[model samples]
Target chain A: MTRGFPVGEFQARLARAQDKLANRELAALLLTTEPEIRYFTGFLTRFWESPSRPWFLVVPAQGKPIAVIPSIGAALMAQTWVEDIRTWRAPNPTDDGASLLSDTLNEVAGNGQIGIPSGPETYVRVPQADWQRIKAATKGDIQSDGGITATLRAVKSSAEIEKIATACDIAGRAFARVPEIASEGISLAQVFRNFQGLLLDEGADWVPYLAGGAGPDGYADVISPATERPLADGDVLMLDTGAVFDGYFCDFDRNFAVRTASATARDAQARLIDAVDRAADIARPGTTALELFHAMDRVVTGGAGGSDSGRLGHGLGMQLTEGLSLIPNDHTELQPGMVITLEPGIETGPGRMMVHEENIVITEHGCRFLSPRAGAELEVMR
Target chain B: MTRGFPVGEFQARLARAQDKLANRELAALLLTTEPEIRYFTGFLTRFWESPSRPWFLVVPAQGKPIAVIPSIGAALMAQTWVEDIRTWRAPNPTDDGASLLSDTLNEVAGNGQIGIPSGPETYVRVPQADWQRIKAATKGDIQSDGGITATLRAVKSSAEIEKIATACDIAGRAFARVPEIASEGISLAQVFRNFQGLLLDEGADWVPYLAGGAGPDGYADVISPATERPLADGDVLMLDTGAVFDGYFCDFDRNFAVRTASATARDAQARLIDAVDRAADIARPGTTALELFHAMDRVVTGGAGGSDSGRLGHGLGMQLTEGLSLIPNDHTELQPGMVITLEPGIETGPGRMMVHEENIVITEHGCRFLSPRAGAELEVMR
Candidate 1:
C-alpha cells in the first residue's frame, strides 16, 4: 500500500559503510557477502540461486559505492542507490567477475590497503577463483576486514528501530489471531494460513520467515507449515515468526494451549515469561550482552526447575539474530538504539519447548519494549 | 498427510551424483551450494543468515557420502541418508568449522583432483574465507567443473517426476480455486494466502515460494509478496507461484482479469495459450531445448504481434528453474523423463499482459503435460 520504506533508509546504510571504511583507514571495503551487499546496496539480487560469484559493494574511503552484480540483474540494480553497477554474464569464470571487481577495487583504492572480508568466519561468498582475481587486481595489500561493516550495522537508527518495532507488532498481532482462526481439528497448514493472512492484512512487506509446530510439547525447531500435524486437545502450539517490515526484521514467538491447559506446559510458560521479565528489568545500556544472558538464564534454570533452553535470547534487527547475542561469549555492551529480543524458555523434552520472545530497544537509561501485547499464557479451543 | 515419497527417492539422487563424479573423472564433488547439497544429502539448512560455514557432503568416487555440518545441525543431518556426520561448535576459529571442513575434503579427495563448482556461473554458498581454507587444505588441484551436478539434476527420476507432477496438480488446483476466492475487493496478500492454503491443504511438504502482483500491465517479476495492493476494476491479476514439495519445486503462473475482462487481455491470453499448446505439441524426445524455444517463440511472437517476453520456459524439478532453459543459447537435447515448463506470454501495455505456464515431461516418444489443467482464456468477473 504505502510505497516500500523511504529510499533514505538505504542511503543511511551506504553512508555508514563509507564511514566504516574511513575509520578503518582502508581505501576500499569489498563486500562479498549477501547480507553486507543487501545492507550497502538496497538490491535483492541474491534470490533463490547459486551465489558462487559473490557480488560486491565496493565502498571507497571517500566516494560513492559501486555494485558488482550478475549481468542479467543489472536492470534491477539500476533502481538502487549504487549508481555504478557492474554485471558479469553467466557461464563466465568467477575469474572474469573477479578481474572486473579487482580492477574496480584497484582503481578505488589506488595504493592504499584494500579491506577484504575473506576470512573463514565472515566470508562465505567469494569463490577461490574470484579471490585470486581480486588478489591480482588489487595493487595494495589485502586484509580481512569484516569488522568495518559489522560495527556499522551493530547500531540501529531511529528509522531502522521503527521498522523493527513495526515487524514485532505485526508478529504479535498474527500470534494473537491464531486462536481465533484455529480450532482443535485444524491442521498446522490452516494455522499457518491464518497467521499469513493476518500478516498480509496488517501490511507485512514480506513473510521473511514463518516456522512453527503444534503438539502437547511446544515446537523447538520451527518448520514450514504442513497438513499432517493437527491441533488436538492439550496441544501446546509454539509459533516462532520472523516477519519483515521494510527489510528490518523482528523474531518473536508465543505459546498457546490448543484445548485444556496442561499443568506442566502452563508452569513452563509462566516461569519462562517471568524470567524474561526479570531479565528485562535488569537490562540497561551499561549491561553487557553476556550479562543479559546470565540474567535470563538464571531465571529459567532456577524458576523452571532445572530447565535448559540454551541462551535466553539474542539481538534482533536487520537480521533475525544480529550482533551481540544474549549468549555467554557475547561481550558487546548494550547501547541506546540497539534493538534486541529477550526470549527465555524450557525445552522440557523432544517436541516439547516453552519459549516467549519480545523485542526491546536499548535506551540511554534502561530499555523500551516494542511488543504490543503483554507476556501472558494463551488458551484456545474449537 | 502421506509420509513424503520414500527415502529411496533421495538415495537415487545421491547415486546419480556419484555417477556424475565418476564420469567427470573427479575423486569427489564438493557440494557448497544449497540446492545441490539438499539434492545429494537431503539436508535442508535455512540460508536465512550468513551460511559462510560450509556444510559439506562429500560423495566419494566409490562409496556412500559423509557430511560435516555445524554441531547444532548434526541431528538434522542424521535424520537423512548421510552415513558419517561430523559437527563443529559455532564461534570457534582455529579448530572450528572451517578446519573441520578442510580436514574432511582433504581426506575424501586426498591427492586426487577435487571437483569444485566454484565459478562465476556457480551459485556460491562457501564464504570467501572458507573457500580459502579449502584451497589451503586440498592436496590436489581444485577443478572448476560447473555443469556436472546440473547435468545429473536436469534428468528427473520416476519419483522426482511424480513429486513435480503432484506439485503441478496442487498449483493448478489452487489456481482453479482463485476463480471463487479472488475478487476485486481482495488484497494481493490475501490472494496469496488463499493460494498457499490450497496448496498446503492438498498436502505440500512446504510452500517455500508464493509471489504475485496486481498491476494494469501484467506483472513480470515475481519477487517478494507486497500484499498491500488491493484488486480493483479492470486490474489484471498475475499469480506466479513456485511450490516446493519434498524439496522439489514446480514454478508456474496464471493471469486473470479483475472485474470485466477487456478485449485486448482476451486476445493476448488466447494467443499465449495457443503458443503454449503449440509448444507442448512439438516437445519430443531427442529434440534440443532450443527447438522447443523456437516453437514457443514463433507462436507467441508471430501470434501476439511481436513482443519478445525473453524466456518461454525452462526445465523444472529439484530447483525452480533447473538445468537448461527454453532460451536461445540452450542446446541441451531433451531426453525422456525430463520435465520442463512451456510458459509463453506477452505484455502489450501496462495492466495488459497474458502469460501461460505449464509443466511437460519429455517421454520416450513425445512430451506429456504434467500439469493436468489445460490452458484457458482469462477468467472474467463482473
Candidate 2:
C-alpha cells in the first residue's frame, strides 16, 4: 500500500463531481478541509495536524484542481496530478494565500455561483477575517455546494473500497492479539496504550482515534479518553479503534470479558451481533439509512431507538465518521459502493451498555463485511 | 501523567482572560476550537479527531464559562471545572446545538460586544450557514477578540510547562533509540513507522506530527512524508517529531549519519546546532521574536534570512505549532513562561536543506533547554 490513489482515481472523482456541479449550476466547488482536498488532488501529509496554515483546492467545471498552498508544500503538490499550483511565503500576517486564492477563484469561477461544502458535518477552515477578504475579492458568488461533494464521496470506487479494506484488515489483525496485553491486572490506560502498539505492529499507519472503557456491565460512554483505573474480574472491556492505512480508516470494535463473564453481558453481546446481521440482511441497493437503523434498533433496543450517542453507525473512509448516518431521521438511500458501519448498542444494566460495530460495503444485491466478524460469544481474557 | 490540569490551573487561566477581557471592554469571549475550549476548561479528549460535531464555549465577563455541546460529550464535560454545561442530542440536522448556543450567547453577552478569537492563526470552526443563523439569533455584536486569548495562551503556566517538559523527555528518549531501528539498508518509511512505535513505548501519549528526509548532503523539504528509499552511506537522515504527553507538545528534530559522513553534512550539522544555541543566548524576558530570528538567521544564513518554511521556530503547546513565530516581521515580545522552539535551517546544496530544532522556555533571566540538547557533531547510525 502507498500514500495516495492512482491518477485515474482522482480523474474519475473529478468527473463525478463535475457532473454534479453542472446539474446544480455551480461553476466550481471550493474545498478547505483535509479529506476534501485530498479527495480531489491526492495530496496527503500529516502536516495538517498543525492548524497554522490553511490549504485550499478549487475544482472548476472542467479541468484539474488548482492548489493555492504555502511555498513549502510546492514540492509535494508537484507529485500530485494538479498542474496549476500557486505558492505564498506562508505565516504571512499580511496575506496568507487569501488574495491568491481569491484570484484563482475569480479565474476559474468567473462571477458564477461558486459553492463550498457548508451543509451538515462540514465547516469552512478559513478564518473569518480572511474569508471576508476572499469573498470580497473573488468574482464568484460563494454559497453552499448543496451536499454535492458529500453525496459523491459516499459512493466509493473499487480502488477506494480496496484501500478501506486494507485498513480494516490491519485493525482486524490488531484486535485478534488484544488478549496478549489486556488481562485482569492491567490498567485501562495501559491497555489503551499497548493496544495502540498492537495496531501499529499489525501495520496501521497511525491510530488517530482510540476510545474504549471497562466496567462490570459496560462503559459509560464511547468517546472518553482512557483512565488509569485497573481492570478487575467480571469487567467487560471494549476497545474501539479507527486505525488508518493509506489515508483510509476502518472503524470497528471488539468486546472481551476479563477473567469472567456475567449472564447479562453474554446475552447482550450475542444480541448486538444478531442485530448487526439483521441490519446487513436488509442492506441492499435501494434501502434507506432509516430502514437499516430500525432493523438493528428492533433487536438492540426492542424498537425503542438509539441512546444519547445519537446514530448507531456512520459512513467511514478517509475519516472515522463521514457522509450518511444511521438514524431514524436520516433517509439517505444506500448505493452499491456505499461503505458503512453497522453498530448496535444494548443496555446490559441500568446505566451501562455494550455496543458492537462492524464495517461493511453495500453491494448490488446485498452487503458484505469488510472487518473480520467477531463471534457471537465474547472473548474471555486471562 | 493525567489527561487534564488541576482546577486551580483552569481557574487561574479564566482569571487572566477575564482581566484581559475587562481591559478590552469585551462582554464575552467565544471559543470554538479544541485548544481554546480546553485552555479555559480542563476538558481533554481525543474525540476531537472526528469532525462530526461542533463544540462551543462561552466565557462571560465575570463568571465561569458555559459549554453548549452535544449530549455525547456532556458527561466528559461535567468532569471539568466548568459548572454551566448545556447539552443537546447531536447529529441533529435540524438544530444541532445552534439555537442553544445562540441563546446562551444572548443571555451572557446581551447585545454587548461579543469577542471571538479571529486574529492571525485563528479560524472560525462553525459552518458559514450555521454561523449566519447563530449571528442572526444573537443580539450581541460579534467581532475579533483582539488577540486576548492568544496572548494569554502564549505564556504557559507552571503546570503547563511541566507537561511540555515531560513530553520533551519522552521524545528525547525516543530519539536516542533511533539507531536501533534506523541504519544502513533500512527503508526510510520503515524508520518512520518504527520511530513512532519507539515514541509510544517511551511514554508519548501520541505522535501527531512526524516528518523528515534522507539524502546525500541534505533533504529537499522538511514537511514531505517518507518514501520507500533506503538509507545509504553519506546520507544525512533528519527526523522531526511533535509528540504529545497530556496534551502538551514538544517540537524538535534529530539528525543522524548513515554509515559514512561527508565534510559538508558534518559542517552543516554543527552550524545548525550553533545557530540554535546563538538564538537561545539572547532569549530573555524582554527580547522580541525578531531578535531571536536574527540571532539564529545570522548563524545559519549569514544574515541572508531563513528559508521558505517561514520561521526559525514557533510556539508549541496544546497544538503542534501555535502562537508566536520567530520571523523578522513577528515583533511579539518574549515574556516569562513563554515556551518556543529554536529551529534554524541551512541549505547545504541546491534545493536541499538540513534544519535543527530545540525546545526552550524563557525564564525571568534567560532561557533553558527543555529538549535534551543534541551533540554538535551528528550521530552516526550503525
Candidate 3:
C-alpha cells in the first residue's frame, strides 16, 4: 500500500546526498533518524516503538550508499535507491544490534572522519557501550555535523511538493466534513473522533495530530478535554490537524463559529485570517521567511490581537512541524515547491481565541495555495 | 486529572537515581528525554510537535532538581516537587527559545561535568547552535550518557505498576468490546475507531494505538492502516491496543474468530495462547527475563498443541512496549511491582494470526495478573 516515491527520483536524491556529503568534507555520514533516512533513501519507518534494531544508512563521500538494517527490513530497504544492503538479526537477543551497526558503520567509514549529525552537542546519546565500540572500531576522528543532511532536505523537489499538496488536499477535505458531524450536544472527544475518522477515510496514512480547544471564555484559556465541558452555542472551536499522506504532512487549523455569533469574535477571527492571507500573498521566491513572518505579524499585533502568540506558521513536509522554523533570523528564502504554513493564531482570553492557518507553496512566479478552501474568513459550522 | 503516584514513593526512586549517578561518576544529570525527566522529576510531556523548545530538569548530584521549561509550562512545573523552575518564552515573534534554554543549562552546570540523559548518542540531538552556545558559555564537559536514568526507569515502582495495571485494564476492556461492535459490513478503520473509543471511554488520556489485520488468510498483523477493507466472515481478527491511563501505557493484543471457526486457525491460536500463558507463569519475582522467554520458547518451538512459533513477549509501561525485553540472554530479573507483558503472537499467513497477551506485575512472592481478561483461548464472535 506504500505508493513509494519514484525510483529514478530517489536515485537523483541519493546523488544529491552524495554531493552534500562531499561538500561538507564528510567521508561518511550515518543516518539514524527516520526523517534523515527517508529524506535521502526513501525508506520510512515507524518510530512509535523502541529503535533497538538500528537502521544506519552510510553515505560515503563517494560511491553507492550502503544501508545497514534489521534483517526483517532487508526487502524493504532494497526498494530504495540504496543498493549495498547489510542485514543484522534485529532484536539481536544479545543486545548486539547497536554494536553490529557500529561495526558496519566502521567498515564503511574506515579511517575517514565520519560525520554524526546533531553532533556531540545533542542531548540524547547512543548507549554508552555502543559509542565506545564505534569509536574503538573507527581509526579516524568521528566528527559530528548534521548540516549536510539538513541542507539537503531543506529544499523540496517537485515530487515531494506533490505529496505535500496531496496531503493538504486530503486534510482540507477531511476538515470540510467536520461540520457535517459536529453538532450541539456532542462531546469534544466524539467530535475529535469524527475528525480523525474523516482523515483516515480520506486515505491518510495517519493523522499526525488533532488538537483543539473550546469554551465561551476566550483565548486566555488553555482548552483541553477537561474543558470538554461540551460545545455550547456561541462556542469558538479551534481545531488543528497535521494529517500525513505518503509520509509528507500538512498542518492546518481553523476557528469555527458554533451556533452563535458575536461581533468581537467575528472581528478577531477576520483579522487573524487576514494576517495569514497577507503572509501568503507576500510569500514568493526570493522572499526571506522572516520578512514573510513580519508582514503577517503586523496585521496580527497592530490589529486587535494578542501580543503573546505562538509562531505565525512553519515549514511542513516529512515531519508535521519541521526543524526549519518561521521566526526572525530564519533567512531560508521562499522557493518554488517549498510548502509552508501561515497560522496567525491569537489566544486572547481563557475561552476566547481564533486561529487561521493555510498551506501554501512558493511558486515560480508567486505562490500556490495548497489548501483549496477560502482563506481570510471564518468557516461558520452550525 | 493527573493520577499522581504517591509523592513519597517517587522520593525513593530519586534516591535510586542518585545512587546510579554516583556509581557512574556523573556529577549531575540533565533530564531531556520525557521518560528520563518523568522518572527523575515526575514531569510529563506529550510526544513532540517539534524539538524547537527543549524541556529539561537539571538533577544536581546534591541538590533539588531545577526545571528549565517553556514559560507557559512554569505553572505546571510549579506543581512538581522541583522548586527551582526556570522559564523560557516559547518561540515568541522574534526569539527562539533554545537560546534561553542553553543559557540556563550552562548556568546550572557551571564548570562541572554535566550528564545529559538520552543525549546525543541516540541520534536525536539538541539543536547544533544550542550545543555550541552551551559550550561557549561554560567550561563544563556536557556528556550524554543517560544510563543512570535508563537504569532507574527500567525498574518500576509500586505506583508505576499500578498505573500500568490501570492502563492494561483499559486495553483489555477495549479489546473485549471489539466483538460487540465489529461486523462483516464494517471497515477495519471503523473497527479501529470502535476499539479506540472504548479505550477513551474507560478514561484513557489518549488512544495510544490500535493496529490489527482483518481477514482469514491468516496472520492478522499490527501496522499502520492502509485500505479501508471491510471485514469478512471467517476472518481472524487481531486486535492490539496501547491504551494509556495516567500517562502509563499497557500494550495488549488478542486474536478473535470473526464469524466462524477454521480448525487450523483455531489450533494455531490455541497453541500461541498457551505458550503466552506458560511464559507468564515463569515471570515470578527473581526469574530472569531470559528464563521466562525460554519457558515460552520451549512450549512454542516444541510444537506444543501445534503452536511452536513466535517470540514470547517483552516489558511494557510508559511506552506501549519498552525496557528489558523478555528475549533470550536478557538477564534482567523480575522484581516486585515491575509490570511487563507476555504477548506470544503468531502470524502464519496474511490475515491469519493468533495472539494472546497479558500484563503481569511481579509480586514479593510470585506475580499477580493485572489484565484479568486473558486471550489464552480464541473468542468466537459468530
For model 2, report DockQ: 0.72
TM-score of each: 0.86, 0.98, 0.86
For model 3, residues B1-382, the per-residue Cα lDDT tens digits are 3366667766887777677677767667766655666766666544244544666677776767877766645644566687888775555424345556556656656677777654212333454455565556655687765566655666787778878877877777767677777877777766765666566666666654666666773543345452378878887777777766666878777777777868767777777767767876666788998788777666655733223222356667776656666666578888876777776656556434556677787888878888875644567887
Task: Provide the fnat value for model 1, as a fraction from 0 to 1.
Answer: 0.18
Candidate 2 local lDDT, B1-382, one digit each (tens): 5557778888888899999899989999999999999999878888887777889999999999999998889888988888899988778777878899999998998988999988766887887778889999999889989988889999998889999999999999999999999988888888988888899889887788899999998999887778889999889999999998988999999999998878998999999989988888899999999899999999988998777888899999999999988988989999999999999999999989899999999999999999999989988886
The lDDT-based order of candidates, best leading, equals 2, 1, 3
Residue A378, model 3: lDDT of: 59
Please report how far candidate 2 places residue A105 from its true position, in Å.
1.8
Q: Is candidate 2 or candidate 3 better by lDDT?
A: 2
Better of 2 and 3 by DockQ: 2
Give the per-residue lDDT of model 3 (tens digit) for A1-382: 3356777876777788777677777778876667777777777544334434456677777777778766646655666778888776555544445566667666776777788666221232354455556667666676665566666666788888888888888888877887876766776766776676677667666664666766652443232332346778877777677777777888877677788756767777777777877787778889998787788778867643233344567777787766445666567787776778887766555534566778888889888888875544556776
Q: After superposition, how far is residue B32 of candidate 2 from its true place, in Å?
A: 1.5
lDDT at residue A293 of model 1 (Cα atoms): 76
Cα lDDT, model 1, residue B320:
69
Best by lDDT: 2
- Residues A1-382, model 2: lDDT tens digits: 6557779999899999999999989999999999999899988889888888889999999998999998888988898999999988788878989999999999899989999998876888887788889999999899999988888889998888998999899999989999999998899888888888888888887888888999997888888878889999999999999998878999999999998989989999999999998999999999999899999999988999777888888899889999888988988999999999998888888768899999999999999999999999988887
